[model samples]
Target: MRIAVLMTNTDESDFSNSWPKDGEKFPAMMRRVRPEWEYVVYSVKDGVFPEVLTGIEGVLITGSPHSVNSGDAWVERLFGLIREIYAAGIPMFGACFGHQAIAKALGGDVAANPKGWVFGLVEKRFADGRSLPLYASHSEQVTKMPKGAEVIASGPDCDVAGFVMGRGVMTTQYHPEMEPAFIAALVEHLADELPSDVTERARASLVKEADMQAMAERIALFIEGQSA
Candidate 1:
């Protein structure tokens, strides 16, 4: 499958060797789920994207450091592009920033969590009685949903941790692309951006192996238009 990976942010400046760029992270994790998938990455934060979505069967939007409400020109352009993709009936999957972006662009609301940053590993509970501990690192969440949006799963702190729109789009506020070690490294990288106590808890929550396989398969299922 040929997938368009819309990478919304660059890697942290201080830690070059500790981890890969945000764009690299997704493909690495996704290849385990769909090894045949070929990715074409666009740096959305740097204003890079295809002129059109022609021939792209699936679209994957990566997490970013920017907020969905930031109103940057690139973000505006991306919102418009998302509409185009949806209009064309292409399947799309979104991660952290992508989740909030998809929600906001589709007429939902995103805001700071009243409970504060929900960093580290979190158990997201699905309506079907299944729970998965996935890596999370976000302060904002989709509060009000857009038309046709359905919440499939949620966490204690973030209600709309996972959602879907029709069969064409699926999103999660957690990072399926991020491994536990990477989350720990990122916790240190983003120490100044969050409270020290939050960072400390995030550090403590790195014990579990991230339940990434199921989430990765979920994205692949959504992209391939199959049952979840």
Candidate 2:
């Protein structure tokens, strides 16, 4: 599969520089499931995008530190590109901020969590009764589902933890690309920004293993036109 990875992260901190970028992080996780797949990355945060989508088989939007509601020019352009991609009937998957952006771009709503930030490992319960542990790091969520979108997963803090629109689009509020060690490092990096209790709890949650491979397989299946 040839996929277009839209990297939306804009962090320039020392921690960000020390770690693998979203472009690298996402492909690393995905290549585990589809070793033969090829990825083309675009730093959409910097206003970079493909001039045409002629050969792109799939699109994957990575998480970003910026919010979808930020009203930036590049964000608006990305939304326009998302609509164009949907109109062209290409399969797309988005994580975290990407998730919120897809929802908002498709006539849904996103807002700050009433209960505040939901960080660390979280268990998402699907309607099929399957639960998966995934790492989360976001302050906002999809408060309203887009028309025709189905809620596939939910968690205690987020009602729309994951959703799907037809066969071509899927999104998740959590970060499956993020591993335990990465989340640990992220929590430490944000120690001064996050609440003490939240940081402590996030640290405590790392002991539980995340279902990264399972989520990756599910995403891969969806993008490949199979039931995920």
Candidate 3:
């Protein structure tokens, strides 16, 4: 499958240099399940996007530090592209900021989390009663579901941890592409920015393994138009 990745991360901190680029994280994780797939990345944060959508089987939007409500020109353009993709019946998946963007673009709402920042690993209970642990690092969330969207997962801290719109679009408020080591490093790197208690608890939660492989497989299946 040929997937177009819209990378929106704009972090240039020293910490980012120690890890793989944001554009590479999703492909690295998805490759475990789809090694034969091809991925092309566009730095949407810098106003870059695919010139043509022909032959693109799927589009994956990566997490970003920027908020969807930032009102930047590129952000608005990305939203327009999202609408175009949806209208064309192309499969799309989003994570974190990408999740919020999808919701807002589809007539939903997003706002700051009333319960405060949800960092580290969180156990999400799905509508089908399946529970899975996933890494989270966000202060904002989707406050309203768009028309025709179904809430797939929810947690105590986040009402809409995951959602799906029809068979073409899926989103997660948490980061399944993030590994334990990467999240651990991120927690420490942003220790000064976040509350000390949050960092401490995030560190403690790392002891339990996240269901990354399972989530990765599910994403691959969804992108392939199979039962996920």
Candidate 2's TM-score: 0.98
lDDT of 3 by residue, 103-218 (tens): 99998999999878899999978889999899999999999899999999998689999999888899999899898889998999899998889899888989987888888888
Return model 2's CA RMSD, one decimal: 0.7
**How well does each candidate superpose onto the true structure, as a TM-score?**
0.95, 0.98, 0.98
Task: Report lDDT (CA) for all predictions.
Answer: 0.87, 0.92, 0.91
| Model 3 Cα RMSD, 1 decimal | 0.9
Scored by lDDT, the top model is 2
Q: Kindly give the number of clashing pairs for every candidate.
A: 0, 0, 0
Top model number, TM-score: 2
Off by over 4 Å in 2: none
On residues 121-191, what C-alpha lDDT tens digit does candidate 1 reach at each position? 88989879999888998889999999999999999688898898898788999888887777877888889
- In candidate 2, where is summed lDDT lowest over 10 consecutive residues? 203-212
Error of 2 at 94 (Å): 0.4
Give the local distance difference test score of model 1.
0.87
| lDDT of candidate 3 at residue 155, scale 0 to 100 | 80
- The runs of at least 3 residues in candidate 1 whose Cα sits more than 4 Å from the true structure, single-residue gaps closed, are 10-12, 16-18
